[model samples]
Each structure stands twice: as C-alpha cells, then as structure tokens.
Target: MDCTRSYWNGRKAVHRRTMMKGAGYCDSDIKTKPHIGVANTYMEGSPGTAHLRTLVEKIKQGIWAAGGIPVEFGVPATCGNVANGAEELKYEQAARDIVAASIEFVAKVHRFDGLVTVASCDNIIAGCYLAMARLNIPTLCVTGGSMTAGIYKGQKMVQAQLDVAVLGGESEEVLLELEEHVCPSFGACPSMGTANTMQMTGEIINFVVPGTGTLPSTDNLKLRRSKEAGEMIVEMTKADRKPSDLITRETLMNAIAFAMATAASTNIVLHLIAIANELGIKITLDDFDHYASKLPCIVGVIPSGPYTVVDFHYAGGALTVMKMIESQIYTNVPTMDGRTWKELLANVEAKSSDIIRTLADPLFKEPGLKILKGNLSPTGSIVRPTGVPAEMKQFSGKARVFSSDLDSFAAIERGEIVAGDVIVIRYEGCVGAPGMTELMVTTDALIAHGLHKSVGLISDARFSGFNYGAIVGHVTPEAAKGGLIALIEEGDIISVDTVQGTINLDVPENIIAERRKKWVCPPPKVKTGLLALYAKNCRTADEGGAMQPWLDDETN
Candidate 1:
C-alpha cells in the first residue's frame, strides 16, 4: 500500500486532501503519485550548497515526469570554513545531528514514500545519511559536486593553498587575487576534503547515484544526474528498496576500503560510525585500522598530494579507483542502480595514472589514515599518515600545552611555538567545547610559519580535512574528561610514531598516575542553549560523538 494513502485515501483524510488541493496539487496528483520528499540543504553564501536550488527544480521536474509528487523542504547546512576559528564553530558538528533530526521530523510527519536528499559539505551529507539510516526509507543522495579549481600564477588553486597563503604573509594584492579566484564556482572545495570525501564514499556505500559524486558542480551533467536521482528514488520506493537493503556491513567495509585507498578525510571515521549506529550496525576505530593496514593510498588529491578533486574526476573518479582495488573491496554488494559492483565497473578504465595510481605503484605504501592508541589515548586517536612527512613520522618532542585552539594559534603567531615542540591543544573535544571544533586555524598558522614539518601537534580537538603535518587529533577520553592529555605539563616529553600507529606520553607511569589523581574535570564551556544540550547528551569521539538518548533511558 502507498504510505501516502494514510493522508489521502479515505474520508478521514478529507482535510489533508483539501489542504493539498489548496496548495495547487490536484486529486490525481494526490491519489495516483507517491509523495517524494526533497530534503534540500540549500543556503545562500555557502559555495558548497548555494547551487542546490537549481538541482531541486530539476529534481521536481523528474519526479513529476515519473508520476510522483515532489514536496520540497529545507534542512540545516553549514560551511566549516565560515565557522572555523570561532566559538560558533562549536555548532558545526552539532549541526549534523540537527540536519538528521530535522529530516526525520519532517519526513515522518508527512509520511514521504521516498526521499531525495540534496546536500553538500561535510556535516550536511553525513547528516543526510544518518537520517536515511534512521528512517530506513528508500532514499538517494544528490551531492552538490566539487568546484572547479581556481588558477593563480598559472597554477591550480584550492582552499588549502589559499589558507596557507593568507597566513604565509603573501602580499595583500596576491591575497586579494587568491580570494577572488580560489573558489571560481559554486560547489564544495575542489579537493578531497570532507565534502568530496563523503560524496565519493557515499556513492561507494550505495547512498548516491553513480558518477554524481565526482562531477563538477557547474557541469550540465550534475543537473541531469539530480533529475535521474529523483526518478530513481520513485522506483526504489515501489520496490521497497529501503536504505537497509542497500547499505550493509559489507557495503560499509567497501566504503572504508575506498576511503583508505583514496586517502580521504579522517572525519569520515566519525560520520561512518554515526550512520552505522543509526542502522544498529557496529563499527569502530578498529575497522578503520584494519583497512588502513591492508589498503594502500592510491589517489593523490590535495592536502595529501599535488592534484585537486577536479583532477580526480578527470582521472576517472570513484569507479576507476574502485576497479583498481577491486580485490580489496567487496564486489557482490547491491548498488542504487540495481546493479552489483562488478557490473558497475565491468568496462571502466582509469584516465589518468598519475592522479589515481595502481595498487602495485601506489602514492603511498601505507594507508592514508590510521588510528593510534597508547597511554595518551587509551581509547584511540586519529592521524593521517599520508599527510605527514617521512622524517617527522617517528618524532618525539617537549610538550607545549594550550587549553584551546585559539591559544595555540596565538602562540604560533607570537613565534612562541618553536621547532621540536609538540603542541598539545586540549578542551575541544565533543563534550569539552560542547562540540568538537576543527583545528584548521592553528594548523594553517603552523603551515604559514614553516613549522608544519619542524613542529608536532596533538589535540583532543579535531582537524579539518585540509590540515596536514605531524598531527594527531580526536584523542578519545579527551582532556576535558581528564584524559592523560590534561595531565601533561610544560616540558614533558611526548612521542608520536605514525609508522607504528602509536602516540605516547613519555612521562613515567607513577608520575602520570599522580598527575591524573590531581587532574580535575573542567567546568562546562557552554551552560545553556543547543550547545549545552549537546554537551549533556553527546557521546565520546570514539562512539561517533552522537547524541544517543537511548543510552540514558533506563526503561530500555
């Protein structure tokens, strides 16, 4: 039976049908077509999502052509670059949950037969997938795609380069030129940052249409794919092809393998775990580690390599990369197009060997990302091995602790952060900051000062996908919760070995115990509003930093 029947089939729904007709929908439109919810995260001033309005129009056209009623609705969207370096940044991660809850609230109330989620950027895409898993409905995602790379001095440019130049003391004229040209079009940053990472990974997990993730936002093809997604979702609903049917443990494993091979964002770890939790599927840091050990980094996108995601798209995108590592990923999994993975890439070929390398001749012999565990992070911590230089991979230095990212950035600006100092930024974890803020500003400062390789950094806070260097982040049992990071004093030694996957506080065990004994959990940074509520309910980073009210319910 059509789920929309509950609102339009009988005399009981007369008022609903009247309201629908009043809104310009006719009787046949209400009775003969399925209701497809177009959950669009479109907001002006956000390059990643600003162009989504056009896609939504095309999607509606496709739905109408496919005999479905398209009901458009708004969802929260945020730009990490806008929120970075401010207290407002705390709302960034929290926005993910808001997007998920918002979609759930509206879709459940209106009883959408199928959903077409239009989103771009990191949190928005992750949140949409979380919503899909929570509702277990027939859904397809439309990623806004990557922006075209900007050209400065005849060299391609992306957000990371602009960030480094701004802090590197470039001339005002040069900076102005970069500001104007770094983002030449409306779309996600033209790199394998969180936005593109989630898009590509989402496609591999079967939540997105094939070829849609890598298409440039300005390309005419993206609009066509949006319409195709709208039409595909209607058929998926008729077949009862719920998210659960497409996304399984094997599919997630495939996503992880793809991420590892491509050297995608570390943020994928948190988003993937959150989506898995919504589906009652168990995924942990160990799963990431397992794939990291087996899969080699092949894609050479920005922050980890010389190319941007535009180059990646031209290099044959996700299908080419997947085909390159087919032996490492699952091939029997179901895709959104009703085809198996093997069938999807049966005739695919890589267009550029330099951007997407073969398994035998990978960009890096090691995985792009790794999970580090030691006394410092009893639970776990994340580091991107592909971003670290070989000389700094196994380094030890004196601790220089700061309570916040701002303080750390200030010290870097003041020339107080010297070479061989392991900068420890704390009190910015999920519950500590009330939302785990990205440390892009501080990382950029380090890069600007030429300290990225000479200095090391560790944080309870997270890092932006564009950040690199000798850094570790998302230290579980974060400093605010009185983790070992909170106990480190100035001049104490810390060691990080990305090759061995270990991050250790080199102080004596007895001394460390004493420090922990004296350590106290700090007061809440935010006392009221959404942040306070998030802090009260949010789980640790290792648990995906999700707000699981079920964990607090004793009745269950």
Candidate 2:
C-alpha cells in the first residue's frame, strides 16, 4: 500500500522523515503511508466555510484509518455576500487563480500522492477543479454543504429573502426577526446560488462523492460523508484514479447539461469554462447555448422556486436529476469511484416531484437559459428565461445608460429610471470593472422600487443566482474595449427578443458607426494590485474570464 512517490522514500525518506519527526510524525507514518494533502478553504468570517474546521478532524481520522497520512493546509475564503459590492468584489475573481496556483504549488512541492480539497464557495470550488486539472492527481472535493432554511413565524426564510427585505426597507421589527433567524447554522446559503451551483458542478463532473453535494451542513449525514470522502481519496489513489482519467470534454458537457436542467446558476457558465480552460478544453458560449437550448429546467430551488438545496438533497440530489436526464448525459462516462455514471445513478429516483419535477412536466417548458447575440453583444449575452413573466421576456425600450454600478443604483434611488427603459450598466465587464461584480444591488433596488416587472436591466456585469426579472448579463466585448455598449448613448432605442434570442441596439448601422468613432476606453479601475493584473491579463467574459499565463498575442 505504499502510495508514496519515489522522492518520499528510500534515501529521500530519511530527509523527509527527519523533517516530519519535528512535526510529530512517526517513522512508520512517513515510510508506508500515502501522503495526502487536504486543502481547506475554511475561514471564520463567512458561514460558507466557517464550519469546515469541525470536518477536518473527522477527515483526518478517516484518512488515518484508510492508511494515509493527511496533511492539511489553509486557503483564503471569501463570501459572495460580503464581497457583493465595493473594492473587495474585484478580488473575488482573482482569488480563483490564487487558489489554483496555491494548490498546484503545494501538491507539486510536497509531492502528495492524492489531494482532497475542502471548499463550498463558487470561486474556491472552481479553483480546486482547475488545480486538479493542472496537477492530474488523484483528487476529490468535499463540499461543506448548504445551510438549512430558516423559519420565521411559520414561513420558511433563506438568505435571499433577507437581502430583499433589508434592501426594500422593511419594518425594523421584521429586519430584527430576520437578523436573528435568517441564517440558522454554519454552511453556504441554502439556495442554488453560486456556492451550491459550484458544488453541484463538481458533483456532476464526478469530482465529488455522489449525493454529498447538497447535504445540509448541520445534518449528521454531511459529517459522515466528509469522513467518507477522506477514505474515498485514499482508495482513488490506490487505484491510480487521477483527475485527468475522469475529467474529459464529455464529462464537462454532462455537468453543463445538469446545470441547465436544475436552473443552477448563470455563473456556472464562467466557472465551467474556466475549469475547462485549465485542461485546454474549448467550451464556448455556443456550447452552453446548445445544451441549454434543449434541456428544460426541471428542478426549482431558491430564486427559481420556493424550495432550497436541502429540498433537492431530500428529493434524491444530483442522482435524481441525472436519472431524469439520463438520455442527455454521457451516462457511461467514467467517475472517481471507478464506476460509470449510469451505474452510480442506477438506484436514484426522485422522492419529491414538487422539488425535482418530472421531465414531461418541468418548471419551464423550454430551457432555463437563453444566449443572445447582436449589436449589443457581438460575442454573446446570457438570460435565464424561466420565471420571467410573458410580457417582460420580449421588449424594446429607450436606453438609459450608466457608466458604473453605483451610478445606476443612484439613478434608481433618485427615481430617474422608468418602466419602459433598458437600464444599461456598462464598463463593468472582466476588463472594465477588472472583476465583473454582480449587479444584484441595482437589480434588487429596482425590484424594491416596484420596477422589476416593467423595467429591463442589461449589463456587461453578472448577477447573483438570486437575481430575477427581465435581466440580461454577461454582455461581451465589453465597453472598456469599445464594444457596442460603449457606443450606446442616452435615448437610443434598444431591442431585446428572448424568443428570437437577440439583444440589439436599435440604432441604424450608419449612426452606430458614427458613434463608435467617438468611443474611448475608460481608465483602469485598479491601477495596481492583483486585481489590476487580472484586469490586464484576463480574457473576455465569453471566454470565461480566465486569467491568461501570457498574452494571447504573444503566442500568436
């Protein structure tokens, strides 16, 4: 059972064990055991990863019992809610590359036989996968699981509602009640937001243990599964089941299809493409549109419906959704457990059709996603078609432009935005904002002001999973680079047709060309720092905004 690499054994073992003894490792522990690195993204600041400290001991016990030496390391963890707006938001995307680089460095330098990444947030999980793809090691991820929904006076409440309530200026008593019970315990927010979406993304790609992605953090099952994951990592190492062996283009597409079916998150498009980029796999916006075009939104969680991820877990988790869409997925694709996807999902069936709907009668008759392209987005833009009212889905309105998110929020607060306006928030794309922050603040503000149904918001930025209404995001070839959005002037007519899948500036071609001649790039938002580096080197949103190692032009 010696899974130790050559550098950790024989003559080199003397040097390694001599160093390990100071750390309290015995001679036997270093010589015969598999050296497994457990990268923990635990921080006390956020509920998403705060409880992972409790899981570490259980994981270590399991690793020891399974004959492996577990060595734990810490990584930075940021909460999406905490980083929602302001200067901190810019670092959110950059942190993914940081985590990937950290993991890769530690795994390579320590020469671990296997890796088990502990994460629950969106970027952390995406970073773990990217690191795994780069290292090609026997790797598995342990999601900290979702929080249980909070109950306030017989009504089930989650984080999103609390955000809306506070932003909408609810009564002080109601705000106090929500502050006391909105988050019941330690875990990611209970909705299918980016955290849960990334967890499901990892699970469907076979990077996590089956059925463990949506388990509630406080549940006894989640703790048990955390330990089980530690054991699974050891087994995977023994069998030489590397990440490259399981992660393929077919598997990535399978994960995308699952996301579409579940109405997971629009952010999955960015994360999945970034992960695929690490493996040199080209997964474009067109590929996402292709899968989303056919897959109906079957599961309803959070902003999409009244349920939470806890409900999805009780309704048979990812396995149930996979079973429902078995025809679309690569059911025979390889998984970390050495079994095909079909075999793993063989026994799973939906226990509650209310949460996970039947394929025949889905939450949305068409796909949950719509990718639009025209003058507004020459590359593309994304729209979650489900839950958008019939009247709001297709509309043409005069353009109301804002150069920044703060400006847009101020306009909404000042009562300048009207019902028949297309609120344009530009200069906030990957290169523009230097981080592409979520427009949830403005989106929620509009909803609070009773304009969610009437007004349409289009952005070069992105949205949180909880965002709803006639919102279109990820407008590519962004304004900072003189894309179509930069040419848009106040009072210009704009048209958006979800049915035809197009978002266009209704201006004549000659006028658009004339306007483009006067467009100029904005100054860098962050003149120096990690975010500045990211903004300088990052690709467009359509390409997943993955930070390039070198400029593409240099390679050319």
Q: Which candidate gets the maximum TM-score versus the true structure?
A: 1
TM value for model 1: 0.98
Worst 10 residues of 2 by lDDT: 546-555
Q: What TM-score, computed on C-alpha atoms, does each candidate reach?
A: 0.98, 0.96
What alpha-carbon RMSD in Å does predicted model 2 have with respect to the real structure? 1.8
150: Cα error in model 1, Å: 0.9
> What TM-score would candidate 2 get against the native?
0.96
Ten-residue stretch with the least lDDT total in model 1 = 547-556
After superposition, the stretches of candidate 1 with alpha carbons farther than 4 Å from their true spots are 1-4, 551-556
What is the model-wide C-alpha lDDT for candidate 1? Answer: 0.88
Best by lDDT: 1
- Any runs in candidate 2 off by more than 4 Å, and if so which? 1-4, 10-15, 550-556
lDDT of 1 by residue, 22-88 (tens): 9899998887688999999999978999999999999988888887899999998889889777779
RMSD of 1: 1.5
